[model samples]
Target: METSKVIVEHIFLLVIVTLFSVLQNAFFAVKLEREGKGGNATAFERVSCAVRNCMDAYPTFLAVMWCAGLCVSQGPAAFAGILYLVVRQKYFVGYMGQTSQSTPGFMFGKRPIFFLILMCMVGILNYLLGHFYGRCYKAQLETLTSVVAALLLIP
Candidate 1:
């Protein structure tokens, strides 16, 4: 697919995911508020905590996603973004259900962010080396990306 197309698609998906998250949080807040009226303060606190946790990570997700997309590859960046969001939603749901059950999703979600960060660094390095020294590391990058894809099962 074309780079522009991939970036557009990635942004579109991000918007959708962001909207869904907003709606979900609103619903949860209302539900938790109602529960709080019935003297279930814990539910309200749980929802608040869950929302807070997700919000805390949102900026980092956006930064790494854009960096990787612009610098590295849009397709892989979009794929990693999807993976992160999916696992993040799972983490949110699990946290609301049972805090302990959120561990796996929380851990898994970080992997994509880490991968994106790695990609961003690699992309920057590739640009620098190529521009400054006229040394192309395209093959090295391909090899590294292949290894990472295999490790992350990003097919």
Candidate 2:
């Protein structure tokens, strides 16, 4: 059983996931604004689509994780919690497209390009395994999350 505080932290991780997704959509809004000749409405409209989807999915995602945490305790499930927060930040930056010679910092940060390959790979695996295995207590599901947690722990 995950402690009450840790479960609270776990919920914070979910918020972090949503925040990163919002950051990505905000970056897209910057692009949208540029494309729209600096029209704020157009930028808001463009970014809202992705933002809405993530917001809508949060409750279901959290509910599933609640079950997983209740079943196996926090240690195993927090593994995915960590993964979601880290990789989504990377994916957010990557999705904003390339930066180069002339303009910079669509959101006021400098970063290397294509550095998210590993982050993305791990994130995808983490997401699928979490979604599939985090909702149940079957042997196979436990085996899968266990394997994934082990793999994540390796240097």
Candidate 3:
């Protein structure tokens, strides 16, 4: 439940996601070679595109996740990060199968990103109110975050 532990989990998740992307690319490359499809575009284009899309969104996901983790709360941030990673993988796999199938994964995965961004906004608001007017909402926000996290089974 400690912040450090949550952050470590986030770091681990980041490593796993990165590794998945890299390994996926390598696998696709090998598959292409084995199929005698060197150079020019091939069926592997779908797989490559899936991987590229996932990597492209990685930076935004990382930023919002860490901002929420450090500024708002770690538990919820960790939960969101895990959800995002899982959905991202789902998106990749689904896309490789069929582009339209990826839509569900994309829709589900964005919730976590949005949640983190909202948390960041709340965190900033909390800080601003407390710093500028001695009306700190830390306790209130923590209670609310915990309640929401509990409802979502965040742990």
How many pairs collide in each candidate, listed in order? 0, 0, 0
The TM-score between candidate 3 and the true structure equals: 0.72
Q: What's the residue-level lDDT of 68 in candidate 3?
A: 75
Q: Arrange candidates by lDDT, descending.
A: 1, 3, 2
- For every candidate in turn, the CA RMSD to the true structure comes to 4.2, 10.3, 5.2
Model 3: worst 10 consecutive residues (lDDT sum)? 146-155
Q: lDDT (CA) for every model shown?
A: 0.75, 0.44, 0.72
By TM-score, rank the candidates, best first. Answer: 1, 3, 2
When summed lDDT is taken over every stretch of 10 residues in candidate 2, the lowest stretch is 106-115
Q: What is the C-alpha local distance difference test score of candidate 3? A: 0.72
Best by lDDT: 1
Task: Work out how many backbone clashes candidate 1 has.
Answer: 0
Residues 1-155 of candidate 1: C-alpha lDDT, one tens digit per residue: 69989667646645554566567657656756776787767776776788788888988888887787766666567667777877887887888888998898898887889998998899999999999999878667756665675566542
Which candidate achieves the best TM-score against the true structure? 1
lDDT of 3 by residue, 106-151 (tens): 9888788888888889999988988999988876776777667544
Per-residue alpha-carbon lDDT of model 2 for 1-155, expressed as tens digits?
A: 56988667745544554455457557655655564575566444544443443345445444544445434433444455455434434433443342231132212111111112222333445556678887433445456555655564332
Model 1, residue 143: distance off in Å is: 7.2
**Clash pairs (backbone) in predicted model 2:** none
Whole-structure CA lDDT of model 1 = 0.75
